[model samples]
Target: MSTPLKTLFDLTGRTALVTGGSRGLGLTMAEALGEFGAKVILTARKQDELDAAVAHLAGLGIEAIAIAADMGKPDEPARVVEAIQAAGQSVDILVNNAGTSWGSKTEEMPLDGWNKLLAVNLTGPFLLAQAVGRAFMLPNCWGRIINIASVEGLLGHHPRMIGTIAYNASKGGLINFTRALAAEWGAQGICVNAIAPGYFPSKLTGYVLDKHGEELRGDTPRGQLGCDDDLKGATLLLASNAGAHITGQTVVVDGGASII
Candidate 1:
């Protein structure tokens, strides 16, 4: 492809912050943004893991920095925002990829587990968005908020899938949150959207992958589960200049799994 065509997906002069970015899907998304020319800031609870992730990205010739923060904490968002500002970075692209999942029967699930899932999956994203938007994005009149949701948000879990009530509910809330925020913020130049992934091989889906790898691959019409690279194209479409007009929607990247 020509350089000009590639420019549509370029993120030059952009700064991105991704939560839960030390490993798994967050790091995957961070790699995509950084590789596309965005200066990326990655956050997770462990400083050492973040350091390793940053080093990996740096080795790839991408500018990446790692910060330590637990997004699940009520006050941590503010601290994270402040840390980014203190480093002289204002997030232009915010990927709310920090999330947690727990599974149990409705009656068997602990209240603590339910609350923890919501705290990370739903509240953390909103708080971080609020911090970044109010502190930076609004003044600049340009921003992108990409929520990493799941197909479970749209449809109930399969009987074979086991308990994930809290996860499902939180993701559903996140989708609605994206729409509501987009409706109010579209004219302000902030685009809120989501990507509802299906059967990605991440920490959240490791159990299923370990147990039903063959079954998952065979059941999906595409005959495959998602890989880290699978997220890059959809992510760039949302974060780069190409997707300016797109907002308030969830782009499902399930490789035909959901439809099948």
Candidate 2:
């Protein structure tokens, strides 16, 4: 028989490690996981931001802790995993939400900017997944990896809209990474997926919103961008038993923008 609805979604004993969880989409997903009963471990570069996020979760009665680490650093992923292990916990869910973007015309985009975007948006997630999977998930024979991709990955951005070629390329690579990793890990009980968010008003996209919010919203069939809670349901589904059979998929949380 199938598990009960509530039971399937219950994450009572699970633990989640969310990179970039101090703010924006990372915090949104972390909040969802914590509210649903997962003990959340958030990692970000700034200690103050991490502390604030932990306190916010605490106000909601969610058990959460924070570890300050720069995902772009080569050694930081291993360091984060080691710290978690030292805490006597293994991550059941890994959210690769730590990322950055660089905007410039394709012809004028600096090599350094491209490299930075790729390092944080693509390479960092790959390193974290490898370390966390080897240390915790693969050994335990169960895991969930959710990569935060962007709609720019799926569709090219118009020059008039925003020229972010490097960011788009990185996210596109991340989507395929999700598929490839899922294929390799599925039999071992690890499910990998990506969330392709359209345009959310967060610290990362505040400038874009301020500049072209109306035009972007008009482009969407729903006539709006994603809100703070837009990702909650999809995140819960993939992180819980409700998504056990789902893998190697990019769940787009855009307000029908991709479709229209």
State every prediction's TM-score relative to the real structure.
0.96, 0.98
Q: Candidate 1, residues 127-166: lDDT per residue as tens digits? A: 9999999999999999999999999899888778668999
lDDT of 2 at 109: 97
> Per-residue CA lDDT of candidate 2, range 1-260, in tens?
96899999999999999999998889989999999899999999999999999999999999999999999988999999999999998899999999998878999999999989999999999999999999999999999999999889999787786689999999999999999999999999999999999999988898899999999999999999999999999999999999999999999989999897
- Stretches off by above 4 angstroms in model 2 are none
Model 1, stretches more than 4 Å misplaced? 1-4
Taking all chains together, the TM-score of candidate 2 against the true structure is 0.98
Which RMSD does model 2 reach against the true structure?
0.8
Candidate-wise lDDT, in order: 0.91, 0.94
